[model samples]
Target: MAVSLLCCDWLKEYKTRHRVGIQIRGTVESISKRFFTEVPCVGQVLGDSFAEIKSLGMPEHFCEDELLFILNTDKRKSLTLKYYARKILYFLRQQNILRSLKTFLEQPEEQQSALEGAVLVDQYCNPLADVTLEGISVQLDEMVEKVKKTLRLKNPSHPSLRCAQGFFSSKAMSIPISLSVLYMTLSHKLGLHLEPVNFPNHFLLRWCQRPRGEGNEKSYQLLRDSLDLYLTINPDNVQYLLLQARLYFHLGIWPEKVLDILQHIQALDPSQHGAVGYLVQHTLEHIQHKKHPVTPDEKRRSAPEHVEVQYSVGLIMKHKRSGYNCVIYGWDPKCTMSQEWITTMRVQQLSKGANQPFYNVLVQDGTCRYAAQENLEPHSAPLEIGHPEVGRYFSEFVETHYVANEELEMRYPEDTRETLGKVHELYHGLSLDSGHQDQASNQPNHTTNM
Candidate 1:
């Protein structure tokens, strides 16, 4: 039977080319200057004007400084600017500016300063989402308890205090943002100050403390030389500075205050690396694509191969007296064939009258073997079942019967035992083969021999 159903639909490209009804030509330099001048600062426009500009597709390369200036025009208290900055940052990530912003954000704070005022607050902030510092902090606390419980369960052998140590060392279970927030919350509750270090696809926390000394003179010296140096140098690192800014923002630090710190760092050093670039690029892209944005093209990627069936064969047994027929299907994707063979045997019995099931069982094995031989060079080693006793019996049976290694043994010790067990379990009235069981029972333990 032919199943004529839709497998997958190929995407059709739709092009909507529009001709410019009116054209104006200008020099590249002049166009660049005009572009900067025409792009309004984030808070300069009212709701209606902002909506119109957004509808027209936000132009690339706007003056971020001017936008900040406008945001701060009314004592740096423009709710409009705050709203847009969040929105822009979100938009930038959607537009694949994540990588760029991550890189820009990672640059030294001084270097980032060049971009501070230039990058509009609206470009990074959005007013639509009702996210609050308190709400996020509460969420962080909840997440921490969850992580701690999960870790305790996952590593019962480890001490409760040490359970979280694995989270730091093991790459397998890297701390996610959700977990980071929890850690941040826990730190606050425990009276330990810690900030999230936003690394790519992972997070780390940092804690700073002042050094102690006995007397005032010694304490002052230690504080100035050791404690002060450590405090001053630690946050100076680009990664640390960006993380501090993020932590401050989450802690309800004023947007302008955050910007001020960001600008100082940017001014000190401008080299772009890691998270900072991701933050910046994400902000810019968001501002430009607030509306009338183009849908990103989807790329078709190949799926990963999971299990491979190595080799397979079929066996048939005919009962002349009862007029019943039984077929045994066997396969080994890897050299270890026992599990697949057992499964196939059960399936064949269950599917005795079903054509599709029988054929599918046979065809799948054949396909797997063919693909393995053709695609894989010089064929990898067949899966070895690794059970020493089973291996010994198999070897002896092949030697005695002069059978090929691939052939299933008719009277192997393990097979005989399994077959006898199944017969006893399934057939209460019938007397089964005793000689095969006796032969298997007489075999010496291979573990002792080893």
Candidate 2:
């Protein structure tokens, strides 16, 4: 996954409070208010109409014409009241607006009274008597650009870009939730109709209107029927779904909702068991931790480790080719082609003074096997190296030629001493190397077999 293992801490905390039916009406109301009053002037325009829609309980008695009038009044010309009216009409049909209002009113009296305190005004009062589609489109385009510019400034290191980098560099999968949020915000500002798909463990956004249709004349009707068509087709574009999931997850969507999104993702890509498994495990871990106290060790053990290894190994390999690093492999009896093997690589560099040697070491496991490239000509490992056992044997040969006088105790530290010892224990007992050494030397210097 492109997601960082570093997010475990945050996810854990999120899981704890992400209980079902955790009402966030107050928070939503607060955001709605700020979005109207403190955000760009466009928000103020949309907020005003929305505020009226809320106050009147989105009356079933109110028709489209009246809503259009409220939106395009003399005070709200710049507001694109028709767009807001269309959105409100869509929400009413979807039952999202009325449902929200009902939920709000059903809350405790203090909560209900709190929402009522916010005043609704003609914040978008447009002096113009009539609005045209062309005008609305032009205004929406400008607003969309403004929102994009604002968000770029607000979150310079956006999560989507980060996720993309993660994918290219480490093969990690990250849900680009923030990017989806940006898309939604921009789409809303631009008056571009869209809908969020709640996929299992992910989210996706779809343009309500198709990019093309049977003909230009049919386009308007197609646009009007877009939502219904989308609901019927139920697109499952993986990339779009993942983006949506990330957005919802970042917005602190309920786990059930997140899972619903992810299930759809799983259905599309069954091999994505790793990602799905992590979601389920981590979410359960969150629930468990909340229900009871967990020790530091328990928490640590529950953390997802796959991406960490991938990231670390990727970093090590990036610098390995400069002859500035070396890898040491320790033998494990249980090791097999399917089992991951650990290798420690050290990056060599000079410290402040020439006399000070510095080494930054990373120990990790890689699924890529050295033997996988055996079919290639002049097949050789990039470093002309193998396990530490091979290095130790080569060291013995070096000792015979150049360091006979130097005692092993004087030259090797404890850790190195142990490594060399293991090498001797494994290979010294076998006479195969002793007998085949010359024969192997006589053969052409082809690739060393793993």
Candidate 3:
């Protein structure tokens, strides 16, 4: 998962509030919004549309048409919504109720799966439309039998079971109540009275009543008797524990807990957990605060040429022999791999041999390589390296190179700045030489028209 860096203080406050029993409302959509608001780097790197889709967990609110609108909005760099319809849309989508209802109207009565009536109720009394509370109530009452029959079904495997159960749980009408609170809060933020309404997933419209207005307001009527199933997660459930570990990693929180869960998963199923093993290794590396385990000591060098690092992290370099483009993420003053690797690659044949700096680079071919500094040159025509682990190290692509994110910066703080500085200096030197040549070409004809 691409990282979403949050404000440390905000995360601390959330943890505190969670401990104190102060509930955090809103659905995953709101959570995703908060995530993007914090980690602007994600949008910068992956493009805004990709980041937006990832945040939703499932693009329930954003169908194919809605996705196109967002994609176009990204390209045009415009489009604003005044209402909290997005939040409601996100929640409905996650509940798997949005599309099911929209498609239901197009299908026969026997084909209607679930939440068809709620979709109708929303269409009729949308907060953006001039519909009455009584009208919404009558619609809800009429759909009660259908909703009850659907909810009462004994199939535990149905995905629709997740929908509106929050309403039928200990707190009835929770969906509407929570949404009302969300509407008020968002309206306050926008300095306007607005609520959520989706025009069958195409348009988002809002309608708000004034304080002294005598007109009937739109409302949601929560249905009853929907069953909610809760599962017990203990230490033995390897799959669930693996998921928990991944969730911790995804949220960018609790490194210790992530490591522990991953370790636990590895322990529970030693033979079949190769992926878990990789995660455990990565977690351990992260915890150790060392990019390379055997970093050579430059200060206590035994020889003059020992541990002399030339290129810094984030530099785009091309291998001289094999001619592959790669980006440096780490380096050791000397080759740090085992003697077996050194022999296999024949490190002794090179000019500097095993004593020269060896960079840890992400190759364009989606593999990592540790190449001797003698083999690398600043790429003549630098382009983006197509590596899977690029996001793990870099945040954004600048004109000529990738910018290191907070994690990479922490690992090698000075490298990012120094690397860019050197590149800029080289560029300026070339530009000055070119300018002088241009000036010479434009000079007055001193040779008397020869």
> Among these predicted structures, which one has the highest lDDT?
3
Q: Give the runs in model 3 whose Cα sits over 4 Å from its true position.
A: 1-307, 447-450
lDDT of 3 by residue, 268-360 (tens): 788637877777677676546422334322222234654477788778899999888999977877889999999999999999889888988
124 in model 1: Cα distance from truth in Å?
8.8
Q: Candidate 2's residue-wise lDDT over 158-234, tens digit each?
A: 65434431133212335557667788999999999777754334465767653321112222222223322232234
Given candidate 2, what's the lDDT at residue 5? Answer: 65
**Model 2, which residues run further than 4 Å from truth?**
1-31, 34-66, 75-87, 90-231, 234-240, 243-259, 266-270, 273-450
Q: Taking the tens digit of each residue's C-alpha lDDT, what string does model 1 give over 62-85?
A: 322223333345331322233343
Better of 2 and 3 by lDDT: 3
Candidate 3 clashing pairs, residues 3+ apart or interchain: 128-207
TM-score of every model versus the real structure: 0.16, 0.20, 0.39
Model 3, TM vs. native: 0.39
lDDT of 3 at 288: 62
lDDT of 3 at 199: 32
Candidate with better lDDT, 1 vs 3 = 3
Taken over the whole model, the C-alpha lDDT of each candidate is 0.33, 0.35, 0.53
